[model samples]
Target: MTPSAIPGPIDPPARLLMGPGPISAYPSVLRAMSAPLVGQYDPYMTQLMGETQELYRGVWATSNDATLLVDGTSRAGIEAAIVSLVRPGDRVLVPVFGRFGHLLAEIAERAMAEVHTIETAWGQVFAPSAIEEAIVRVKPTLLALVQGDTSTTMNQPLDEIGAICERHGVLFYSDATASLGGNDFEADAWGLDAATAGLQKCLGGPSGSSPITLSERAVEVIRSRGRIEAGIREDGDASAADFVRSNYFDLGMILDYWGPRRLNHHTEATSMLYAARECARVLLLEGRDAVIERHRVSGAAMLAGVEGLGLTVFGDVAHKMNNVVAVEIPAGVPGDAARAALLEDFGIEIGTSFGPLHGRVWRIGTMGYNAREDAVLTTLAALEQVLRRFGASVPAGGGVDAAADVYRGAA
Candidate 1:
């Protein structure tokens, strides 16, 4: 390849991301990413890091001092928390309801923990009694769960599960990547030992950084397994015999880097840090409850719109998340083709489901910056066109009108 063949600076076409995340980032978040770079230890950079931790405390509704940003995607946070908390051969219980639930079980297996799973149907969430019964049988050292799984648009109830784990003396962790910021999550009140989330969902930013918080108990476990790397080791520093296996995901070392110790780990991903900081700042400015309410309204509108178009909604509608809804594909409509047509002709994007729901349902999202009146109405209107074009019967102006009624009711 010739040097001249190099592509021009990235100039991608714009489209509304109405699928399950990596959704449209807030405009302010994009502007934050472009801020001039600063040294990792620059006073301003350190200040921003500390401030981000505090802001996330409000976001998580927790007083945990161990809260901070992980230098990778949302999955990175999940791995960091699990691997650091669960030692080799430790038992871990996971309750699977959808794709992400399986992801938690898989990560636990990779950590070499003896993983146990109890699953309900794809569209169903477990009752508190069911989780408690599993806890009694497994007696696991950790209970790993996903608060929201986009695959089925289902939100597992975490509020009661935490107390169940506490009674059984098990560490409770939740992957809130698809739920936090857009839903009600009380890390402290829910008795979560650890929780992690990504920015691309309801946080209104790109996917590079993850926000994570750890309870004091969770922090104690991670620190007990601490191992400072050789070159960075100082006179009195110590390492545990069963230290966390993955250096990159060792929460203890990461903590030293974020803590007042000012220790060096990896050179910070400065721009992503800026983006993370701004996402929290913006959410706090808008008021956390207010942002969640916006998501509730948008999700309800999307659900009504699809139903109004004569589409069937999937899952236990009573327990669906406030940000995404799964609409069953009509018998005659080609799901992928309709989605592609919507992308090409309307310049919008929605998602197809995975696993059992694959080819059976389309997952539509109203989240982050795209959770608005105009975005909901436009997507429904465009989708009506796409469905009709694909030879599916849809009510004329039905989707828009139903969605509008929802907004009016919300107002």
Candidate 2:
């Protein structure tokens, strides 16, 4: 296809993104991404990286000096943490509750760890005792888990799990990609050795960069594996590992780039870093508690609205995630068709479930900048219209009314 044969500049239909992540980016974040690029070693660029690290520290609620951006998407952050932390033959325990749990196991396995999992039914979270039992049985060097699983719209309770890992002398790691900024997360207080998140979800930015934080324990593990290959170190210095294995994904080198010495690694993705910095800056200026409360209220409104539409929610309602909700697909209605209609006709986007729940549930998200009153109400109203068009018996205006009532009660 020749360039001239292709379509001309077209405006994307403005969408109300109520899907599972890559949520609508804030205007400031988008603007930041459009800023001019600079050479990687430019002093101003280096200062930008330092500022990004500090901003992420505030978002993550951590004082860990090793915090920085991983050059890929959120999963890159996940892989970097696992591959760097779990050495060959190390034991790692993962509590499987959704698709992302399996992801942690797969990454650990690739890292050559002896991976053990304590799995609960999909849409369910592990009890504190259950996790404690797993830790006792496995005696793992690390415990990896996800704070929120968008596939099931479930938020696993983390505070207790952290304590359990701590008691078992295990290092706890979490993927807070879908939960941070919109929900409660404490790195130091929760005893997390490492936690990685993405800018795309609750941070209101694009997916090119990942924000990661490492505790002292996590840092020690990385440092132990650091080695100056043949000519890289001083003569007679103790030899480290033959090589760090994965070069691009190595957090040790990434840390040095963020550290005072500012060693070389991959050329940082300047635009994405700017976007990440602005996202965190927006969150910090908004106040963490205030942002969390906004998500809570907006999510509550979405849940109430869906229930008022006479649709049953898919997960344990009490343990649902603050940024996303899973609603059962109405009988006789094609799930994909409903989602397409919502997008094409209403200019709204919602997600479907993954794995075993595929085609059985719709995942509606209230995340990042979209977690607002107007977004919630508009989504509910559009959903009602779509469902009614499909002959689903939804009470007219009931969903929006219920959502309004929820907001009023909260106010």
Candidate 3:
């Protein structure tokens, strides 16, 4: 294409994402991304990487030295941890509650692990004892879990599972992509061996960067099968008899690169590193507990507002995530049409369910930069309008008023 024919200065539409994830990045995060790049091994770049590691340590609530950023999206962190830890035929038990749980099990199977999955209804989480029983029966090498599955808008309680996993000698790993900053996750205190999260949800950034933390045990497992690239091999250097399956997703090599050794792997995603760093900075600045409380308040408003619109909340309300809600689609309203109108007509984006809940529920999120009173109220108000337009009866201004009541109580 000619220079003239090519599009000029890319401009994207202004959107307010009040959906499950990939919401608007915090202003500081975007500005950080726009900063000038530095060379991979440049002192400044490495320094920034080190700083980011420290900040993420706080985000994960861990003192583990393996805290670092994986270059791809949330799934990269997940795959890295699983592939590096699960040797062929190693038993892995996954307790499935929603789509992401099934996803974890799928990844484990592909990694050549003998995977066992115990499942519950989509909108419900398992009791810790049920998982402990499974661990005893399966005698698995690892327990892969999800902290929050946005598909069901449920955040599984991890506080007790970690202890149970510890008792049964199961390595505990959780994907916190949908609940990290806006929810409570104690990586060390909860006995989590490895925890991974993404930038797009509660972290208030884009989806490219994934922050991951590994405990001493988790690091030892990865280090055992560590492999050095052929180009970087030295005379005395050695690799494990069975090296990691995927070169790109290998956590051992990535660890060396992030550590003081500074061994070359892939060139760091520098701009994403900056954004991830700032996301942690801004999050910590607000105080983790305070940020969580904000999500709680805003999510409550969204729930109340939706109920006021005469909609049913899905699943177990007591265990729903603090950032997203799954409301059942009204009987007469077309779920897709309502979502489309919410986007095309109101410039607001909301999410629909996946798998079992598809076409039956709308997954609305109040997370990241969009976790605010106005964002919640606006989404609710707009949703009410769309449903009413689609021939569903909605009480006028009831949604807004109920949301106001929530805010008033929160204040």
TM-score list, all predictions = 0.97, 0.96, 0.97
What is the TM-score of candidate 2? 0.96
Error of 2 at 7 (Å): 5.1
Tell me model 3's lDDT, rounded to 2 decimals.
0.92
Query: Which lDDT tens digits does candidate 2 get at residues 69-122?
Result: 999999999999998888878899999999999999999998888999989998
Task: Work out how many backbone clashes candidate 2 has.
Answer: 0
Global local distance difference test of model 1: 0.94
Off by over 4 Å in 1: 1-3, 226-228, 231-241
- lDDT of all predictions, in order shown? 0.94, 0.90, 0.92
Sort by TM-score, best first: 1, 3, 2
